[model samples]
Target: MSRLPPAIFLMGPTAAGKTDLAIELAQALPCELISVDSALVYRGMDIGTAKPPSALLEAFPHRLIDIRDPAQSYSAAEFVSDAREAMAEISASGRIPLLVGGTMLYYRALLDGLAEMPPADAQIRAALEAQAEAEGLAALHRQLAEVDPESAARIHPNDPQRLVRALEVYRVSGMSMSEHRARQRAQKAGAGESERSILPYTVAQLSIAPAQRQVLHHRIEQRFVQMVEQGFVEEVETLRERRDLNPEMPSMRAVGYRQVWSYLDGDYARDEMLQRGVAATRQLAKRQLTWLRGWDGIHWLETSARDNLPRALKYLESLSILS
Candidate 1:
């Protein structure tokens, strides 16, 4: 085996201080930050997406953020291509690529190659949406659990976008998303191990998480409250007024954005929106943690620890990826 150039991954649930830690790492090492988040790709989605403030973003200059309009869609395949390109550009400039975010599916697609799946079928998706509306998302999730339990376990009941897509895949192809992944894995296992990494560089993954579950829950609630105070509702309202956007679109379906969009649509009152938004965010964090636990070779640090920075640096130092 031969050594490949190194790239760093900073993964964590939302409100885990990943952005702050990435900034510190970029300042301390020769690295360029590349955002791995799905929601941050859209412009004008700042407050609800928890995007870094303009000043902070200007200073840090993360790649792959604000590169798309909310009306457009970004798929995992696109993310793989974009992330690989950014990684190569940074590596060519003799800098480490520090990828950071809580979007686990993006990270997974980048690391383990995405399975060859069918494109989005509008008819199938529309039927699933109709089913969701008629019976609620819980009913659809229950149906998914029967057909594709593996994906159902990973996807939250409230994550209608993913749930709809999963059922769509099953309906269109007669194969679950989990089955597609299994086939891909079997193919890789049969193939020779010559090309282990799809990306050019070897990856060193670092994870930040709170040791206590209640502590993380508290932070999630606090952060959502702060976002509301900072005009999250107003932000969603502006997006809602756009004729091209809708609540069903992928961008509008992001955690807080979706709930706020519902509030704006008169589906719920402001107080209910706040409660639902925070609860949805907590569920999102729980799902992210589930994804993180399945990954191998990650150095986990407690986000609430005072010495998290030093501990993270120590891990990088041990890997000889940082000075």
Candidate 2:
């Protein structure tokens, strides 16, 4: 049998050294780097997003970074579309696509097909946002818990964007988002379709998970401190100055950016902000790992393992996607 063309998924929690591994793989393989990160898509979000430096990017270019303004919203659906096009382009040029990032949702949407849910209803979304403002996101999340406990449990109360979206999905379709997804899965399975092959490509997934969770937590804290030292606060301040941007915007809600925005708004002191930022990042990593755990056919590597690249190469070679 002919081996399917390969697409590499280098996924992990934040501060997992995915970027360096991706560059190393790109050098060793015929692959193009396509960022699977949502935050990296925003132009001015470099420092907080931990985007690769210009010199490094010049050496190993990553597609889909700096593609959006800070105020604009980029959804998982959009990421799937953009990634498919980039992957096709790369494959046509006889190069594999190495998608690298911590955005598990984007990775899932690209790999496992999403249900054909209704598109965003701006009027309904606006109304939901208004209601959230009046009643608070936690309150809205409570309402979601009543309707879609599965989604509510998965979504954080402080996550207004997801809260509003879940509520909007329910209000519009009279069915919870989780229910819709479940139904989609049932239908697909009944039809003898593989949910993981949503897109037309052979994928070799590589996940970098730290053996000790505390190791990841420590890395998260240290990375945030480094981000602060690298002008993360100034980056958020610049975005804060933009009239169109605000704390509620999805871009600003990014882990470090959100905490820094709160600090800038006098919501907390610098020390508290640093603490909250690190905590929020750790939470984000935990969430990413949860998603990673549920995924199938991934080659898991301990992030602290010294020979991760060799292990990943061996796994890919075993699959005949790399030789």
Candidate 3:
């Protein structure tokens, strides 16, 4: 396949030093940083999301961040559209596009286009939201089991966001979520795969080695505490003012936002907020690692950030992708 410049993917778990690495790489590589983070898309979700500071963002070109209000809906399909636009502009400007962040599904959507699911139905959305509120997430799980047993089995009972989305898709399309998912899985992966495919661009996954789990966890905890010190509570309070956007909304339910919302709602003691935040971050990291382990076309750097860049550049050079 002909190269379309390197589209380096700097991905790792939460608080795993991904942003710092990406920032440093941007200074050396001919790349424009584009975020694949699901949470960073929302505006006013600053400290809790661990978003880059304004000054840092100004120092480097970044995209797909703070483009929507907290109440606005931003899905993977939307992310693909926006990310591609950013990529094109960056490429035209003679720069590589560095895709970064830990949102695995967003990265997947960027690499492999989303299936053409039906547009959402307001009525169906209302019904599913009501059912989720009244019957709770378990009932949604059972509903998923009835419609798409495979996806139901795959998704956790507590992953209310995905459960509701699956149900909504079925309700709007008059087809089971399983059917749509099956079709998506049936598609082949390769050159000229689809317009959404990022194969024309180079990609790699750099890791800090698996043995550093303890260190990673410690970093995650330290980051959350730092976020708290940096006014994470105030950030959530600002988002809380928008009551129309419930904690169940896609943007509101983002990891840090959700935890901070709980703090605002008085669900936890003041001290417990930091503890709960740290645990949620750890869970997010676990999920990120799980996703990376299953991804294809992603070569591991096999070293910590300090030693990973040169090795990663070497791998990119071998692949003829660091144009």
- What tens-digit string does per-residue lDDT give for candidate 3 at 1-323? 55555567777777777777777678778878998898888788888888899999999757988899888888788888888888888888988788888888787777766767777778887888798889899999998999889778656676887887888888888787679856765664423355445445655555443347898888888888888889888878876776687887888777767777887888988788778778877887887888787776676653354676777778778877664
Provide the TM-score for each candidate, comma-separated.
Answer: 0.94, 0.95, 0.87
Please state every model's RMSD to the true fold in angstroms. Answer: 1.8, 1.7, 3.0
lDDT of 1 at 149: 99
Over the full model, what C-alpha lDDT does candidate 2 score relative to the true structure?
A: 0.89
Query: lDDT of all predictions, in order shown?
Result: 0.89, 0.89, 0.77
Measured by TM-score, the strongest candidate is 2
| True lDDT of residue 139, candidate 3 | 96
Q: List pairs with backbone clashes in candidate 2.
A: none
> Over the stretch 1-323, how does candidate 2's per-residue lDDT look in tens digits?
65567888999999988988888788889889999998999998999999999999998999999999988999888988899999999988999999999988888888776678867899999999899889888889899999999999789888988898899999999999999999999999999998865877788899887889999999999999999998999998888888998887888888888889889889999999999999999999988888888878888888778898888888888988875
Instruction: Write the number of the candidate with greater TM-score, choosing between 1 and 2.
Output: 2
**How many residue pairs clash per model?**
0, 0, 0
